[model samples]
Target: MTDETQIMEINKPISKTVVAIKRIDYVDIAKGIGIVLVVMGHNDFALISPFAHKLIYSFHMPMFFFMSGMFFKPDLPFLMYARHRFNRVLKPFLFMILFIYFASISFSNVGIPQASRRLIKALYGNGHYLDWVQLWFLPHLFVVSLFAYFFFQAVYRRGLFPLRWVILSVLFIGGVLGITLFWPFEPDILGRGFTVFGLPFSLDLVFVSGFFSSWGMS
Candidate 1:
């Protein structure tokens, strides 16, 4: 067989296979645009004018998270929910981690020992060490989804809580307090004031996320 014919024969699976799925054009398009804005803001934040960066920063994440919240199925069965989280969030998170490990060790010339240490740290919230600021969102999103799921199940789903909205308000207030109150709790190393990062599990902004996600339920 000719080289071109042989190549075509070998590529039959990809070339001939097709799969179709329904999609909502507006939602998908809006989300695509939102993602572009966010990526542009992050990637070229410094290069772009400060005002433009500020504009993107102001709206992009809120829009993204709000859309995410809008899709959360609070009433989903526990097993299905767990499997969905695993397939969607955990899989991407693990893949990002593996990619980071390779990039740090090879492209960044970091040693395995140091890279592994950073990998562990990155799993929680330390993306700065790996120079991977973006992946921090993945873990934080997973945690926030879990928080919303449990909260929804306990209060709204069960119908056992009376002042649920009031409780939400109180928690929101407390979350605000937590952001300002980080330094006092930041001290760790031998009682020295080392200070925690901007947020843990994105809890500094958990109030915002929680609000939107909860809003999605109603």
Candidate 2:
């Protein structure tokens, strides 16, 4: 190899870090329970007991979202988090979309024009069921985590957290009222409600799940 190649290799990022984390058994158990509930809710056998599925659906998302938020560090650098999200969420998202898209082209009547249009929409995340129903949650969770990181730093990092909780209690009531009245939109904060497959990074869910994310942060 040339000296230029050697220099480039030496400058490359090591791309690995070792950190010890204490595992909390109950948290894992709760997440596992939520996962089971999510599966059961989607299973066709669940049609036999709709109310049970409803109960599972009611709490499972919140439980899952809360668990996701619980480990967020308010102090982590944004670029670091972006890199993490790109690896964990965006990579999987792109891979799955490509896999599903190609599978469709192979098995279905998807012509070049149709497939290209589908690719555009899928990349933008502009559909309610973007290519597949299950994949939407990862991007939505990614978006909500972004909101939580900033919100936690702004509210909690400055010692305003205790008072903010009191204020948030009132706001939570208002949020519930608004949700009840206005079809799940939250007045388009920070101008991020732009549309894509369904909402870019699942923007609408950012507000709703943000509550859970912030709660977990606390």
- Model 2 residue 165 CA deviation (Å) reads 2.5
Error of 2 at 176 (Å): 4.8
In angstroms, the error of model 2 at 144 is: 0.8
108-194 per-residue lDDT for model 1 (tens digits): 779999888877777656344335777767766776777778888878768856767787788778776776564334656876766
59 in model 1: Cα distance from truth in Å?
Answer: 2.0
Could you tell me which 10 consecutive residues in candidate 1 have the lowest summed lDDT? 122-131
Candidate 1, number of clashes: 0
Model 1, which residues run further than 4 Å from truth? 1-20, 45-47, 126-130, 158-170, 187-195, 198-200
Displacement of the residue 199 alpha carbon in candidate 2, Å: 2.8
Cα-lDDT of candidate 2:
0.73
For every model shown, what is its TM-score relative to the native structure? Answer: 0.74, 0.75
